[model samples]
Target: MTKEIWLNLPVKDVEASKAFFTAIGFTPKPDQSAPGERACFQAGKSIIMLFPDATLKQFNGGLGVNDTSTTSQMMISFDAETKEEIDELADKVKKAGGNVFSEPSEVQGWMYGFAFADLDGHRWNGLYMDFSKMK
Candidate 1:
């Protein structure tokens, strides 16, 4: 009965993180109840919810989140319609104050992408895959 999925992430600053995502073209989902404490964005068919560090810890039952600076938690991938889109996103991420860990490059002659870390160090990558190049 699962109709949709949402990703809840911990952020050091909701406002800054929201701005970063917005700069990279993620559509914001307005929620007046939480104000500066939370932010939500629509990434394709999924929803990404960002909460202040302490707020997310409370929601996680005090388990806390990873220290992204030293830990590799996960890589969230975004599908691009073309290779140019991937390149464009990488540039946007860098301009938005994100760390572009991996420069845009071809992968196996079929996929092209680049990885970046958000201001809070959450890893993400935008990829464009050409199925026709696959055997």
Candidate 2:
């Protein structure tokens, strides 16, 4: 079984990223954060690591940094256990100063969800999956 997971993302400003996530209900994991360069947040059992772009570049080898404004290679999604939870989270995203690209609605019949872009323009989605409706 997979024990744990970590999603690492590059941010222009670590402090701002931390504030954004915190405002949107993500809890900061101080033990996991690396002082000024990295900010860590908890997303369920996963750890979300927000590192300064330059610091992230050092670990990227040659893949290069992602230009989230021009292109999106990743979209972080949060799983919701209830439809209401999805709606609540969607609202929180906007309240935290994030942009909602897709408002809460039925998606593919089985998913009740919404999509938003964080302060760093990182795309994220919150969805409630109805397993019985999936075909």
Best by lDDT: 1
Model 2 agreement with the true structure over 12-126: per-residue lDDT tens digits: 8888888889988899999878767899998999989998888888888856787888999889888988999888888888888899999999999999999999988999998
TM-score of 2: 0.92
| Candidate 2 clash pair list | none
Please report, in order, the local distance difference test score of every candidate based on alpha carbons: 0.90, 0.89
lDDT of 1 by residue, 1-135 (tens): 776678999988899899999999999988622667889988999999999888888988899799999997899988999889898999999999999999999988899999999999999988999999976
Stretches of candidate 1 above 4 Å error?
none
Supply the global lDDT for candidate 1: 0.90
Candidate 1, residue 90: lDDT? 91
RMSD versus native structure for model 2: 1.4
